[model samples]
Target: MFSYCTDPAALDGLAWFSCYLTTGKHMSIYYAVGTVLLLLAITAPLSLAFGFGGATAARSQILPLRWFGNTYIAIVRGVPDIAFFLFFVIALDQAFEYLRHRIKCPDWEAEVWQGNDFIVCAAAKLPLGNAPQWVHETYGFSLAVLTFAIVFGAFAANVLFGAMRAVPRGQIETAEAYGMTSRQTFWRVIVPQMWVYALPGLSNLWMVLIKATPLLFLLGVEDIVYWARELGGTKTPQFTDYPHGDWRMWYFLALLVFYLGFTKISEVVLDRIMARLTHGQAAAAGEAQRKAAA
Candidate 1:
């Protein structure tokens, strides 16, 4: 980033540090921050959509639909998240390849699981065997995002389901009395009122989702943690221009500050949202707002 950074070995003090931080590997660390932010932006809404659908389905009039939704929530939430992450990514990846194998290589007569190996045709490989590096990285990241969405979506579903139930029965009854159908009552009456109740739980879930971004390493993505360990490790003179002792502590300290700042900002935003949602509702929060305004 600096003209003075041309020779890292000759530099000293702040100049040396400046050149060190400007290295290509360190640039990747900055990009990793953006990656984390991108994952959060995409995953939040996707998880919410999944949760909403799961919560609505759990309350469906049809028995089978309700059973399916309930089972989804129960099973996913019941299992440890790490276990689910490890299992689901492999399963979903194989399942995708299996479908592709059926479509691309119908004539092939090989079993997919042949004694500890998942054998699929070359055409069936996701991104193909000769695909570019970016394709492979994107495929892995996509799988990680889906795993996060599914696991957290289950928790969000449980929060939303309870929130839906917490809406006063009288409100729903009044909608029914006003000639609203079940669907209409749900959308117009129940949905609007449930947000205030759900906000706290959802806020907590959002924090959890933020914290869970580090787990991306487990999914084979070269995330911030991977970069920190790589760049901060002891680098001998033979390896590169920049040589440093174990700096993992400093790297981790920076990460800690990053998360703390992110969560604090989130706290401010969610508090404002909660206050806005509380206006004119029957909940105690809404009542407090009304009294304060008076």
Candidate 2:
């Protein structure tokens, strides 16, 4: 926000708008946009890592490992994501506090759950009763991040499992025939080759992850959607120097633009990755590269 303008009345049309958009609340709105982007950045890799592990687990010849992996993917698909988010955040939070309550307030226990409210000792609070506001915000954000990672990680695992299976089985056998150990063949051959098949599903999952960032609001994370709705509401001249009409539509539009720009960039990046993945494979993309080279 520009200094030199002490009063909102000093600002004219566009300046008024700029000042309005740059208010502390609006600055938080801007940060909220970053918050959503950072969420996608964090969730994407973490989900991919999880998916890889889960896919590996599901593929194991060992029955118990396979059952566990398959069950993880299936359970998430069965539950509604919103329900999982709602239930898990509170459940996880309370679980943490309950554990803390046991450790911290072992002597003074009047039951953790008294009807609807989850009462924990002051010391057992997630951010503590007297913690800074920022600490609470950070804690909420951490929960949101964990929620996103867990939900999307399951979906990613499903996609990756399919991708791993879609890789030609003969190639793995060929590696075995060449005297490569099972683990060596998995890393050196199957793992590297699986991406060509994985890219399509993973990219789609990424797009879904991008759109789902708005759900952070439902989790009380005060993300862009939350701030946009808050600051974009009408403000009276009596209440504030800058008065405005209902601006939720405008704020939502801005969010739409932000998401579109993010997805466009993601598309470009995923395309590049796919290009690299398909460079020497027997897919049409690899054939085209060969043709060009020839």
C-alpha local distance difference test of each model: 0.93, 0.86
> Which candidate achieves the best TM-score against the true structure?
1
Q: TM-score of the candidate numbered 1?
A: 0.98
Local distance difference test, candidate 2: 0.86
Candidate closest to the true structure, highest lDDT: 1
Mind giving the per-residue lDDT tens digits that candidate 1 earns over 146-255? 99999999999999999999999999999999999998999999999999999999999999999999889888888898898988899999998899899998998999
The list of candidate 1 runs beyond 4 A from truth reads none
lDDT of 2 by residue, 89-144 (tens): 98889898999989999898487778988888889989887899999998998889
Position 99, candidate 2: lDDT? 93
**Residue pairs in clash, model 2:** none
Using all chains and alpha carbons, the TM-scores for the candidates as numbered come to: 0.98, 0.94
Q: What lDDT score is found at residue 90 in candidate 1? A: 88
